[model samples]
Target: MRILFGLAVLCAVVVTGISYFVLYRYVSDVPENKICGNIYIGNVNVSGRTKKEAKKLMEQHLKEDAALEITMKVGDKSAGATLEELGLAYKDIGKVVDKAVEYGKKGRLFTRYRQIKGLEKEKLVLNEGFVLDAEKTKAVIEERVEVLAEHAKDAGITKSADGFDITKEKKGETVDEKASAEMIRKYLNSGWDHKGFKVKMAVKTEEPSVKASDLESIKDELGSFSTDAGGGERWKNLKAGVDRINGSILMPGEELSVHDTTAPYDAEHGYVEAGSYENGQVVDSYGGGICQVSTTLYNAVLYAELEVLERYPHSMLVAYVDPSRDAAIAGDYLDLRFKNSYDTPIFIAAEIDSANQMRFTIYGKDTRADGRTVEYESETLTTEDYGVTYKENKEAELGSMQYAGSPHTGKTARLWKVVYENGAEVSRDVINNSTYEKSDQIVEVGTMSDNAEAAELVRKAIASQDKAAIEAAVAQAKGMSAAGSDNAGEEN
Candidate 1:
């Protein structure tokens, strides 16, 4: 019995010595300020290093991850942004390092020793938790995606000297904003284990609204109208306006603004000072004769049976077209707008003939029957007589007379569209109504005269509102001024 007890005591002492040695080794291997061995943070080995050193090493490794590039692609086109640009970052690197630092330095001595040994067999890799700002990620993703998108181009017809040139339509692509945002969110949150990655956006094809086939039906002439555009500086402006408007194609349900098409009427745009009517007097203004172009186009559009969205008549009556048939365009406000009411596209072909006639021909599929014909007629509703106005000129000698403005008769009228089928009148409808203002005849009479008698005679003639009387008085005053000048020379 004594021998057995001694043996058991010896075994117990040996076991205690072994345990004490292991405890001492564990204590020595793990420092108070350093992380234990076999520990990792995001693929970075933080073993046998202090908390500060481990944090630096892990941050360097994560810096590479943050700089990783992610590209959003559509076909061959691509746009890229970095993870850091997307506001991705480690949520709490310090807390993770603290946890790592206290890995084997917690609990009782034996438990701590056991944890250290366990780390030797298996690694304790602490995943650096990540966080991304929702707004930042979404905004970055959306901007990049928008830059990557392509716009669709419709097939259109451009007028050529030979005939017409048909351009092919280009296919376009666009992405769903919500889907793209979700896609980027999922990718960043998941384990993205790469330096760079390409994500194909969820794209959809956008087809052109007007295909080439739709414009094929625009061969026949639906309507043609012409007006005399006299030559000179005003004609130059008219030709420039026509050059801009020629070959314009109007798609179905599309409205064309004449002002928008031929605007910026300045010297740079090939316009010169010419005659234009303003407030009862012919005034010199830029883009003077462009109104004739719009008026001709208006007649053509009306004949084509197109819908006139907006049309404004001149403040005074124009000599080019009848009372209610003219359309005028001034600045941004007064514009001639018309829509292509047909199913097919409408092509505008404008040209200045050798006779100085501005003509506009509209081409589209003529759906009207062969025997059907249409015409427009202007009906006068009321008329006002024009008055005469005289202005005194101080610079003129004695009784000089000059015509300032022409007289215009004011009238209110309506345009009627008459349709005849098989040579019999079928319908007559009022298409548009217009009211024109009566403009006065302006005359400048000389009041600066040394002889009061001559000036008073001229004033009486002007007050009479008679052109013949004014002419006779002006002649008499001129004779008296010539006689007075002769007498003054003789006296000298």
Candidate 2:
């Protein structure tokens, strides 16, 4: 019994010594010489180790698990606590350091867990701002440049004697290159992406040959004129008049006026006779037959369907052209002008024939409305009559203004409306109120008692186109009548 008890005691003492040694070694191995808080292997601090030892140990542990958890403190939280409860992780300190060293060589690198989180936020913000997709914006700016170039080309800058032309140079005083460049730059910097943007452009320019051809046609039409047909100087005078209208160019969208082109009436230009129009009781100086040219161009403009900016009609009946259809120009007071509103270029060709007839033709691309047709209708709206004015009978007495003579009646002024249509009634407009002047009546007073009877016999003779009849009428009337007399005596 004694021997067994001694053996048991010895065994117990040995076991106790072994336990103490093991505890001492474990406590010593954990560094106590450095600053201490908690033991951190990978930012994860566990109690019983110094901060330096934990950091060193963490670097060693990262070799095995590069993605180790990191430990963060919560309010009043204890060290070595569960990271899950604090919504944090203990990241591998050594791995982070290694990664930072690698990426830092290229650019910025995260230092701590907080820094990594901050970097993620910054990346998101940058993505929301300026994008790197320059293809779309670049294309949009390129397209704008092309369109601006085309517009510049169409605004033709021609060299002419009228002035120093500066339109053709790509960069010069007249070129709008700066404006175009700025427009394009502004468009690109407007923060738009043109990933799926589309553009449709139409470019137009006037051909040089077309412009030359138009001028040639005008010259040909005006050049064909002859003067020596009639014995009178009227034909010669008319030829000189037609020569004035030459070498004028009408640009697109420009208006050409008749009064603007006609030369001033002067003896130097061979205008011998002045034109006159009756106003009230007296005749007034006015441009005479210029209305013929104006009216002809007006008809041509109508046929071309150009935009009529302004137009006026003659005050008195004109025998050269239809009364209501005539267009009259009296300097700035009245004008026959039209604007070339078509997209293509247009030229006006005017010709005056030897017969004192004028014609105007417009040349341009055919712009006829394929599916449309126009119709015109005329309607009389109103009429008015002015009292007749009489001329003194050369054969009558001084107080005689009327006698047995052919009575001339005044004409009724009629207002007319012209309607224009295209598939439907486009517009209905009133043209003008046309007035006609009346012819006067006169009676011849003769020395014979049968003066009235003799005057009637003379009237029958005057009615004939025979030259002898006109002479006989004149002789009988003169021999029997006094100035301003109503009759030599009551007419037959």
Candidate 3:
């Protein structure tokens, strides 16, 4: 019995040793540069393959995977491009391939033998070859999806013979860039089957501020005013300024600045040298006649019953509008700013008609009571007569005189806005109080150096502070100088 038990134990031990030697030899038989049997690198079976051969196979798989189409859908609009077109390429796979090759070849002979044997029951699969640049991926996504983007359009108004034409507003659509890029990344890292992909792109909706319905009620002509659009370069400036301001829609509580809308008054912006008021004189400046446009718009706004937030009078009175009614826009300090205080939006229509008149017509919903009328009255509180001013001119012939500028009368005035209901007076409100500086009639008197007599006579005439006396003295001195020139010519 003892001898039979010993024989059974020896047979079992011998069988186990033979199996261990077989597994160890199998694991060791794999080429030094070859991956062990039953190992995969990212779904590409590299079992029993050299490192170079495994890399070649993985490169082929990467090419196919890169060629796979990635589709992004924004609503029903879809954009698609292959991963290669989107600048995606797998990171270096040499290390991962080496890792796979080293598997079942590490540790003691028994451990390696057991690993090689375990491959038959549970195959080794490695997650590799999907890393991509984040910025590059996002850039491609944005470029491809740009065509799917739509910008929101606000409702617009156009003038018509009947009333106004309201254009319909449109909603916008844009892609969610971050989420789209992340979706692709997450799928490639975990669930990618080396095939084409379809992603429902995250899209955002944009709303319009003034919907078509909101402009439906803005059809009435609230107020309209027409001023003389002056001629020449000033006229062209007026046209340019008016063109910028035309078709402007001012919503409720929104203010409009004449300077802001038509600024940077340079030749590039279509403005040329034209006459404008500076230092109590009319001088040539860029966008010179811009104030007339603002004044016209100011009157229209006043008649429309809009709120005037800022207004400034010209240095002197303008011939186009009343003293207190004119609105001047200079640099940034002076601007004709007004707000749409009505419950609805307002539209400004400006043009220089064939009659050489610049007109600004305000159109909006008229909520004023029926039979109610509005009018503005200008009252002169005080007035001062301008005097004659004489300045000496050395180059002119003796006693010759020239007018430098026209005289301006000084006045303190106030404007009143009166509301009448059913042809009966109801309320009167003071709009503004303005003061205009008086300018003297500037006359340049000649002071010829050779003629002391003529110079003294001109000086006495200027001191008299009389226009007629100064003119007579200038004429006499000019005649004496002419007579002396004629006598000298005859003697020669």
Each model's total of backbone clashes: 0, 26, 0
Estimated TM-score for each candidate: 0.58, 0.37, 0.60
As a whole number from 0 to 100, the lDDT of residue 157 in candidate 3 is 89
| Better candidate number, 1 or 2, judged by TM-score | 1
Q: Considering summed lDDT, which 10 consecutive residues are worst modelled in model 1?
A: 185-194
Query: What's the CA error at residue 283 for candidate 2, in Å?
Result: 6.2
Top candidate, metric TM-score = 3
Candidate 1 local distance difference test against the native? 0.85
146-258: candidate 3 lDDT, tens digit per residue: 57778588899889787688899999866777777767777887857878878887767778877888888787889989988768788889989999999898888999999
Where does candidate 2 stray beyond 4 Å? 1-242, 274-276, 280-287, 354-357, 371-378, 383-387, 391-492
Q: What value does the lDDT take at residue 263 in candidate 3?
A: 94
Stretches of candidate 1 off by over 4 Å are 1-153, 158-164, 171-209, 450-492
lDDT string, candidate 1, 373-442, tens digits: 8999999999999987887776776567677786889999999999999989999999888988898877
Score candidate 2 by TM-score against the native.
0.37
- The better-scoring model by lDDT among 1 and 2 is 1
